[model samples]
Target: MTIQFYLNGELRREDAVSPTTTVLDYLRVSAGKTGTKEGCAEGDCGACTIVVVRKNGDDEPLYEAVNSCLLILPQLDGANVVTVEGLARDGHFDPVQTAMVESDGTQCGFCTPGFIMALFALRQGNEKITDGTIHDALAGNLCRCTGYRPIVQAAHQACQDATKDLYGELSPLIPGEGYEHNHQKFFAPQNLSQLAEMRTDYPKAMILAGGTDLGLLFSKDRDPLEAIIYTSSVAELGEIEETKDYLEIGAAVTYTRILPYFERLYPSFATLITRIGSRQIRNVGTIGGNIGTASPIGDTLPCLIALDAMLTLYSKTGSRELPLEDFFIEYRKTDLKPGEFIKSIRIPKLKNKQKFRAYKISKRYDQDISSVIGAYRIEIDGLRVKDIRIAFGGMAEIPKRAVACEGAILDKEWVEDTALKAGLAVTTDFKPLSDHRASKDYRLCVAANLFIRLYRDLTDAEDLMEVVAA
Candidate 1:
């Protein structure tokens, strides 16, 4: 079987290629298109950034920046992909490239392609051009030599005119059919029944949604996944529905796509989601994938657990719904049965008198994993605490609620003394292990402090997200 896609408006059919081959390798070795550089095969460094242009429901083309290093050859099946090489036309530099040249954006020249591609996506978007937006777009692309002043100037230069290009100018093309090569199979199922049947057939097959985490297996760990059932192609799993009760986010919905609704409905939670990854990561990372991985330090887990979210698991046998909290059985383990995969997550919308806030303490400000992610949702009546839910990631073997601490503060008056007691009660929760991220003591200490921050953030108008200027 062959994988089909459009590269620079030209149709590409790839056969006899290894299923586990990263797009970075395919671009450099097989295709001889080396414009997309590979600095960190782990997708941290955006040196391998590329643009994927596809059609949305409205028949309008959407161009998104993705890390080629983290992309498997099969993920591009039936999609349109553009690398740095595709940006030029008739020997003329794209606006982004022209701007970069004028502003001296390239110094070492290795990471320039990635920066240009990232900026290209920004230029094509209908966003307000600001330093913050530009910075967020380029956060994943790191250039040590250039202080980023020139690159930002280049972004400004490119956006001075509305970006019009060959990219997204044509109608979107449909994705390719499934393929199998050398005992490895890549399945792209369009409907839930097809997905469920595929899972039933390939019990141990890897379920890949956004490939943010699963892509690391092949990129970094070199795991040649024998069979992969990609959920991103499943229309049902990719749907996002809003109801009177909850926000039903399909398992395949990327963080970038769901962010706008989150921003409108859950601002604090949206802020935390922004911190989950850089714009590049979020472009392909899904919240359902986050829940499926069941990682203890998952950025969204703390928020989901605190929100009292529910997971809908689908299998060939049937479908079941369970509390997100109950989904985690232990470290890196979930209650999901064989042939079962996460279908969707339903998060209840905040209502009148309900307040929610999430705090993340990390070693760095941007694109770094959390040392501790604390999410809190509380309901208050006057000075009395009516109801509260608290959850933390990176403070235990699983993203868990501080049940004892919640008990300590429940129905208590919102005060410093009350917060102190609840903070101290955090010890009753799981004992976090010491690792490179933080020490056990540090985790516990921050866990206690977050409750205080959450209280202050909820009671007063003081922004916990703000950094005090010097």
Candidate 2:
């Protein structure tokens, strides 16, 4: 089969490129689109930023800035891709390029293309062009020379008058076929039944969603696979539904797609997700992958486990439900049966009387791993605690509930003094190890202090626990 996509406005149909070839290498070698530079082979560096124009459910084009180095060729199978070379007409620059040059935004010129493309997407978006928005838009694109004042100024200048985007009127390309090379198959099933059959047929196949972490195997570690199944193509696995009790999120839903829901329902949880990675990372990372990875410090797992979320697994034979807290058996181990795959996650809505909060303590503010993440759900009946659930990451072998701490907080007065007792009770829980992010003692101190922080924020006038500005 052939892998087809619109590259820089022209149609590209390739039958020879391997499934493992990243968009960065493809652009430099095969397509000859070198304008998109490769700064960091990993997704962290925005040096290889590119815009992908794909159709949403309503068939409207949505543009997103993605790291080309981590983006595989198959990911753009049926989409419109715009590189820096696509933004010019005869020698004139796009609005972003024009604004940059006019506003003195370029200095070293090494990271210009990535910044241009990133800002280009910002100009096309409806977000207000301010210092905060501009900083977020260009967070992935780093430049050591120009500083950010001029870039922010250029972004503000360029986005002053919104105009038609380059791909505004263009029709979106549809992914209608799968590809195979070197006898390796990539099954892109369009429906749920096909995905189930494919999963059963190839139980050992590597399941890919967004490819944020999965691509690291090939992009950075040089680990190649034999067979793979792409979950992004399965439409049903991307649908989000809200029922009377639970919010069903498809396993393939990206963080960007789910952040708004979290912000509206659980603001603290949404705040922690924004700290997961930069805009480029969140655009492709999925919550299902976080649970599937089963890392002890996964930013979302502690909150999800504390919220009593459930997972819906599917197989060719049938489907089953498992609690999120029980899914993780141990370090790097999950209770996944053979031929079983996660289809969706059901998160119960927070009750009116329930108070939910999540805290993440990391070394740096952004793009950093958490040393300790605490998620709490407390219910109070006037002065007495009705119920309390506390889960922690980076504080145990798994994303687990603080059973001892919860017991101490249960049936007690919801006051600072009771919080102090609960803090001391967490000493009976698992002993956290010392690491680069924090020491064993530091982790425990932070973990214990978070309980007190939660109490103070709930009882005090200020909401110091709420995360803002990113």
- Models 1 onward score TM values of 0.96, 0.95
Off by over 4 Å in 1: 168-172, 461-470
Considering only N, C-alpha and C atoms within 3 Å, which residue pairs clash in candidate 2? none
lDDT agreement with native, every candidate = 0.87, 0.85
Candidate 1: tens digits of C-alpha lDDT, residues 1-470:
78888887788888999888998889999889888898988878899999887666686777889999898998888788888998888899999999999998875657989999999999987789999999989999987664899999999999989846756364345665588888989999999999999999999888998889988898898888789999999989999999987899999999999999999988998988887778889999999999988999899998988888999999888999999999999999999999899999999988788888888899988889999988888888897989899999998899999999999888998876788899999899768899999999999998898777776766555432342321
What is the per-residue lDDT of model 2 for residues 1-470, given as tens digits with 9 covering 90 to 100? 88888877788898898888888989988888888887778887688899887665576666789888887888888878898899987787788889999999986646888888899888877677788888888878877655888888899888997885666344456785477889777778888889888888888889888887887877787665777888888988898998778798999999988988999889999989888877888888888888889999999999998999999998888999999999999898999888888899999998988889999999877777899999999898898999888999999889999999999899998877788888897789869988778888998898999988898768745433342211
Best by lDDT: 1
User: Which candidate's TM-score is highest?
Assistant: 1
Pairs with backbone N, CA or C atoms under 3 Å apart (clashes), candidate 1: 78-175, 78-176
Q: Supply every candidate's count of residue pairs whose N, Cα or C atoms clash at under 3 angstroms.
A: 2, 0
